[model samples]
Target: MADLKKTELEERAFETAKTLLAKYQNPHNLKLEENSNLEDCYTILITLLYAEILEETEQLAILSIIDGMKLLDGNR
Candidate 1:
């Protein structure tokens, strides 16, 4: 049950990351190939997130999203 919940949370985080990345990319005119690595996208996302002024909740969410990404990478 716990694992299922964790997986669901991770999926949500991943979706959030994807949505944010798309929004960021569009405004900046950044382009990524179809085969771009997840870790590379994660790095760019984190860097961009840190560049902005975010609330504590928003920061925590991004940290959790990054952790979720790392776990997906089998780093956790």
Candidate 2:
């Protein structure tokens, strides 16, 4: 709802997204934060998105991310 406070929604969504993304990230990868691969960074971004839209359909999120990534790829 548009009436909801921005912080409340963001916090809830971020928490939701993080929980789902946490399922895939390997703890050992945290050892080399600066050298983390793009895949790992993507995972983190997706997790952040998830936490923001915890109740969102995964298909929609995946599709959105795929489209967004394509735009980034084009910049290269």
Candidate 3:
């Protein structure tokens, strides 16, 4: 399989985050800021309502989170 360029990866992350954000009822009408970096965007989304956000993102989020955990665990 071909590797994705940085831009392609970032774009995919942005789209996935946007789709996840849309699932929230968002009483505050929170929006992902254009000026914020990807990490910040993800932080806001995940922190807003952790479990719900994870649930909304579903399989992709689960796999990514597990992968991240493994990386962190290995690094420790």
Q: Write the per-residue lDDT of candidate 3 for residues 2-56, one digit (tens) a residue.
A: 7644443345445655766776566656577555555655554455545463554
- Number of the top-ranking candidate, with lDDT as the measure: 1
Candidate with the greatest TM-score versus the true structure: 3
Q: Quantify all predictions' global Cα lDDT against the true fold.
A: 0.59, 0.48, 0.56
TM-score of candidate 1 against the unseen true structure: 0.45
**lDDT ranking, high to low:** 1, 3, 2
Worst 10 residues of 2 by lDDT: 26-35
Please write out the lDDT profile of model 1 over residues 1-76, one tens digit for every residue.
3433334544555555565666554455444444445554565567668666656766787787777766767954
Pairwise TM-score winner, candidates 2 and 3: 3
Worst lDDT run of 10 residues, candidate 1, spans 1-10
Query: Candidate 2 has what TM-score?
Result: 0.35
Question: Arrange candidates by TM-score, highest first: which order?
Answer: 3, 1, 2
Point out where model 2 deviates above 4 Å: 1-17, 22-38, 41-56
TM-score of each: 0.45, 0.35, 0.48
TM-score comparison, 1 vs 3, better candidate? 3
